[model samples]
Target: MKIHQLQALVASAETGSIRAAARSLGISQAAVTRSLRELEAAEQLPLLIRAPEGISFTEYGKTLLTHARLVLNQLEHAQNDLARFRGRAEGRLSVGVTPWITLTFLAETVLLFRKRMPDIQLELFESLMAVAQPLLRAGDMDFVIGQLHPSTATQEFSCEPVLNYETAVMVRRGHPRQHCRSVHELLDQDWALNFAPDGQDALIEYLFTRHGAQIEASRIVRAQSLGTLQMLVERADMCTWCPTVLQTAPLFQGQLVALALNEKFDSRQLSIVTRRNSTLGGAARCFIECLLQVIRKHARSARKEDLALFDTLTLLV
Candidate 1:
């Protein structure tokens, strides 16, 4: 029930060791143990089970940890509110974003935000939409900017569409399949998949399977970072499906090109997801305004280049 006890619980669970949790919280090891004991004593239940390897959370421990994070996040927000009321420095704003959003609007937004709100701290986490969903739900993030599939965009979250675009095949310039027009030609080649979203993988599987390639079982290189993905595609024969906007990535440096595939990829809808019915703080709203502004500006700025790139990306079919 105590805030420090909840903080200890979260820190211990995340760090996987009581000593490490104490170090993270800048408290003594005994304090961490005492906090955990207090938590369990109040609930009259075992929260964590210790073992030779490390401690593992019990079912109740996991549940409490989830709430603990939520409570901590709420407290942080409250602190931010109070700080601003007292004319102190603005508070921290944590956001979860997808790579597409990162490569598209995030940098510009950060730059603009810093120019306007110099005191506000910004934290950015980039991952797949699926990975960010749990982080947002657990209150680790103020908002999430990512692609939203219809099936995964549940009613629990409110989704506001920011960008809508289909994906395209990305490859190094002068690759053999540039103008080949056949999906089959590229099937046997190794690939880089940045994220394994539900329908995203299925579309690739369906196409390869339908093309008499039977390559659905073949493992594609999974690249977690944009630079790695680009490096793999540029230095090797690997290809990837990516947003056409990715052409703007610094790693591409005009070395990579977006090719039109013979078939199609599922539609990709980029949106901002927030807890459904949650009120947005003034700072959060301001951040969204900056983000949307950047999105629009990037779209406008990329229009001419995208048109040129789209015209060049072609499959013989």
Candidate 2:
């Protein structure tokens, strides 16, 4: 079968629909159908079983899909290697990011990279961690930056720890609960939670339940957008858990305050991730190095701040 036909088969299998596969491949539906038909005829087997809901792959189709993925991966590697050898670090690099980091560091990273590598194009997709992981494995994204859980670490992907931030309760300045130093004292307050199937909210839920505190399900306002959540916290008495990066956000200038948790809760680890076996081009490698440098700089600044705080405490004593 032709490479295009094989690619169509693989895309259709992954997406579970000809229309979606066609859209992802940037081709017409008719063309995709024609390619599938050609492949089926050449192989003399029914690759897909059409159903009312969507398409399902047959046994042969399943086997072929495994081979298709390997072939496509090798082809992509060859292309990347050739581009590198030609001294043209030019190809579309897709990146996945979380909402919090998008507001905190994504823009800065993109701007800095663009200034350095004007020829390299970038496509960014933002979503929750669950969605980002699958896309990264499917060759949809060259790399991703966000919270990395233990279950997400697999043989195909490698994660590098970038930074860790404590989850703190955030409220608007002058909040009545801001004076409270205990988690129990703030439990009655309404919370704006990031509502996702698998996200920080679930982790918070586990932590509360483990401590014999039941989270008020009704009081949890679901928010998928950080900006929207920040607005809610700014305008109302609602509070939410956030990382320290939000403290530097300009949206809620002099309005937001992060309350320390009474007992130390889990800290989220931000990680930079890429395919374990995939070879990165020069541009991607340089960009990664720059990101690591920025992280180091932030860490050094944090150490200096801590030293200053210690000095002030000594003088007060």
Candidate 3:
């Protein structure tokens, strides 16, 4: 009912215990216990199961926690908006970005954003759309600029395409199959892919459909992080289909090489993804504008450095 009551519940859930929640909230343990009891009494349902180890949410508590997070985040956004209108640029902005953006324009965007809103707390997470979706839905992250998964439903979010995501099969520099020109020639080798749960089948289909080569799932390794996929490709014969931007990052400078297959994979887009119908706060809006400015600036340049690194980038902006 009350805002503080909701905050108490959320803090308890996040911190995992009553005493920890009380400490985070700058309140006494007894007050935290009282708020939890009051919330439970108001809802006429048990919200938390307190134990010596920690506090665990009941199913009811789990459901309410989601809404509680949304409510709290929205309230913070309202406060931030008011502060911005009063010429006070101070608020927290949480955003998720894929690896390519970091290698390309994120540094420029951050510098631009910080100059305008120096007091705003910026939190950046290196995440794929699959990893960032739940946080966006729960209002834990303000937005994400990453590749959108075609197989995943996005009716709950708004995705605005910014750049076309080009990909290629990559392997270690001296791997035996590195010179293979056809997908069929590499089917027998191990494959490591970094993709969403539903995106694996689609990527696999794209990689092999041209050659009509069917790959067994047993030969494929599902990678959760870019580091893991990089390790697999660099240390072993495992090959990966990833953003062509990897070829430009210093981390992969000489260790990895893209296979020049005659076939091309399906096109994906890098988009600015945010919750549907949600108004972005001041810090979030300013950061997105900075990101777009960098993208547009680079897209218009004909410098040799830009051409070599961003040749495959086709901007939708």
Q: Please report the candidate that would top lDDT against the real structure.
A: 3
Model 3 lDDT on a 0 to 1 scale = 0.85
TM-score of each: 0.81, 0.74, 0.91
- Candidate 1, residues 1-317, lDDT tens digits: the string is 99999999999888999999999999999999999999899999999998878799999999898889877877787787778778864888888888756764578888888876679888888877657777787887888877755665676688887656667787888887777676777867888875544544665565566656556446587776766777788888788877776676554648777776667666566677887755555567778889878655544455765454333232111
For candidate 3, the per-residue lDDT at 19 reads 92
The residue-level lDDT of candidate 1 at 151 comes to 60
Candidate 3, 149-224: lDDT as tens digits: 6434357778888888678888888899878898888888999886666767876777786569899888899877
TM-score: the better of candidates 1 and 2: 1
Clashing residue pairs in candidate 3 (N, C-alpha, C atoms within 3 angstroms): none
Q: Ten residues in a row with the worst lDDT in model 1?
A: 308-317
Give candidate 3's total backbone clashes. 0
Ranking by TM-score: 3, 1, 2
